[model samples]
Target: MSIKLDYKPVVVLTDYMYDSIQPFQDVYDRAGFEFRPYQCKTAEEIIQVAKDADAVQVHFAKITKEIIDALPKCRLIVRSAVGMDNIDVAAATAAGIPVANVPDYGIEDVSTHAILLMLAITKKFNILTRTVQEGMWDYAVTKPVHRIQNRVFGLMGCGAIARCAAKKAQAFGMRVIAYDPYLKQDQVNDLDIILKSAKEVAQESDVVSVHLPLTSETKEIIDREFFGWMKPGAFLINTARGGVIQERDLLQALQTGQIAGAGLDVLSQEYIEKDDPLLQMNNVIITPHAAWYSEEAEFTLLTSAAEEVVRGLNGEPLKHPFNKIPYAKQL
Candidate 1:
């Protein structure tokens, strides 16, 4: 007897997510499945686009319970990036849809970006650039810069990015410290990074970098109390999720000189309609969440996500399965 295989429709969610999907277009085409790309800007649009899709490729867009319930045919939700916090994982699981992500896609790129942010802030690069651009030679000379050597560098989460940052910091002759309850002492010791409590990391470090995922326990993790514990004249660098640090509190901290400065690659809102408080603060540097946006990282992310999709289609185990439930439960 001969058996026939069915090719399911795979939907690419939005324009912003297309760059990661474009590279894999040929792969999907050759796999004998229908590839549908939609420019969905809202949750309603996402539901409509993914309504008949067998798998939906998603980015930072919201994937609510209503959308998940609407997508009756969606067998998988493939996230182009590592973070799955934007998607309603529980709802997807209930709907019998497995979520897949590309977790290791941007580790080196993001870690390098974090270190760049730290170095820029420590040396007052942004201020110096503005002063020079305005033709104020005296202002450029007035700005003071600090060396990285012998300074204490703290990491909030000892994940891939944190580990990468620790290694880079050590190479620069900085003392690296990290606080993560999930990490074993032996593991931390092996990295040659100091293990400290969250409060202690905040208090003792001259430069603090946040690398944790955003969860209920970590949301607004850096607030007034957290900032209060930091050493005076220290710098804060956040290459992690935006919500991890409260924007309003950060503005106040900057205005009050609570800390010397900050380098932020992510924000609570990507598209701010009005002049945000953070923008008004001269001491704060902001990037449009481009920490994981390097060409090399984008290629890795694209290829990784594509491989996951192909693996799913082939009925094989995914390289980065976001949810791995029991087979009995899945059935």
Candidate 2:
């Protein structure tokens, strides 16, 4: 069988998701790019399969400069999820390629996950579950719990997802405070959330929920000193990327009882080592980075990502373009 390799530009999807990529076929056909699905993980794999691609839609694949530089025909890169940390944006910028992501797809799920974690940590839900399973029926194991009302719920970022979380937390009669220098105080005020300094939020809140993005500035932003500012026996929750917290520092604080507990949906390393200290602590609730999951949410995320690539290919502004488009070389 002779496969035709005409002058038509190609759109390569870096990896597959449980959801179908069939929706993209019509978009690709209309945009003059042939939709090609390829399974690529490492930098080398991406470079090999996407070398001639005009636009690349990356799922869980790493888009390194080596791969970016190798793709001479590539014009745009779209991340399947909210975070663009998986891709080397600087390298793509240097190569004159624009980077875009779907920032709003999982706002409902992730925010709800944050609220769930907050309540579980504060109420000692895991401890109670384990104790009951082990034949201990006494409620004394979870004694001295404070009421949720009037407690400060601190947010690290007041972005779309965090805003949704604020609304949910407020529904529980909790005061929502946030620290996000990117947004003006009035913007946070519009959401009925008090804008405070990072330290102030940490110092005052009974529970701190992180919803910040992972950037150079935000990486390891929550270190030992930040933990020191936390109220004694306060709870910490992270539904955002994990690089924002230093795990060793978090463990130390937990060990010293400076912080009461943590609810981590992500970790500094997603492939947590077998001997990870946090794994042994009952106060710590560790999930396999699945906060943004639901059968419905997964489909939305995949479908939205495919649509963003079509926009990129058409040289149209995306739903959430992370950076200023470095170039306009479109399909």
Candidate 3:
């Protein structure tokens, strides 16, 4: 699509949970462009609102191929979050629109959340707190709780967040081991984390934490087979995508005593039914996909996403490019 000489470039935000868009507006104002925010849930809605947009900053809205094809002037597509699964990156690349994401904004917050989950589940915080609130002052209500020190903590994917989690676990005197085929032993040598095979990590760890992105290859990667490998008393933590572990398998594992407990920050489905079995289980701790949250992180996420739009408009390289494409010519 050719640009119109008289046309003013516009940036569209498909959706956002923020109470204010001022962070985005500030960046767009300095760049001298229009910043439009819309709560679009469907491709048709996005197409109608962003047809003339020079860039699109998306948060949770699915930027499908249909929406991508409709944006004739779209030079960039930026996901406000770390994962690009919500946006069709391949479609954007084929259309010569580079896709970017804010990957670094939530590193500390998410890693910290992972550690929180670890401690809460291992310490039986839920059971103890609930029993106490019920006027039962017996410590025996949370019987069989174990110490964290010197226990094996296995990580499924040793990315930045997992590495940070390792440091936190180490501070509590836990031994950290990880399994990530993408990394070599030398890469993690400085951190003192032992790299092991997936099976070995599952078999040896007192707690197995998942830190993988949701992709075709990783969907349901932690299923019955992996659970079978885990010790019957071992715990499981997943602050990453929920689809990484099969929910049915996880429930079965928790029921049959194959695994002790689970701490989940995300789910395969965002909304769980009121009577979901996972919620009924006392051994489970679930958060509302809020691992990547903090007042500071929120500001950083919005600012970085807006900056990507500015970079695209200025023909500058994206700080976190998800796809490679020829830079769009300046208007």
What is the TM-score of each predicted model, taking all chains together? Answer: 0.91, 0.93, 0.96
lDDT of each: 0.80, 0.86, 0.90
Stretches off by above 4 angstroms in model 3 are 1-7, 326-329
The predicted structure with the larger TM-score, 2 or 3, is 3
Winning candidate number (TM-score): 3
Q: Candidate 1: misplaced stretches above 4 Å?
A: 1-9, 12-21, 139-144, 272-274, 326-331
Residue 145, candidate 2: Cα error in Å is 1.1
Number of backbone collisions per candidate: 0, 0, 0
| lDDT, model 3 | 0.90
Ranking by lDDT: 3, 2, 1
Candidates ranked, most accurate by TM-score first: 3, 2, 1
Could you say which candidate leads in lDDT?
3
Please give, for residues 1-331, the per-residue lDDT of candidate 1 as tens digits: 1113644546555435543466677667777667776667888898777787767877777788998898777767788887778988888888777888888988998899899999888887777788889887765463566788999999999999889988999999999988898977888787898789999999999999999888888999899999999887899999988889987787778889888899999877676545777766667778878888878888777777766776675566667677783121111
Candidate 3 structure quality by residue, lDDT tens digits, 1-331: 3455466679899899998889998988887778899999788999999998888889999989988988888888889998777888889888888888888898899999999999999999999999999998998878899999999999999999999999999999999999999999999999999999999999999999899988888899999999999999899999999999999999999999999999999999887888999999989999999999899999998888998878777777778788866365566
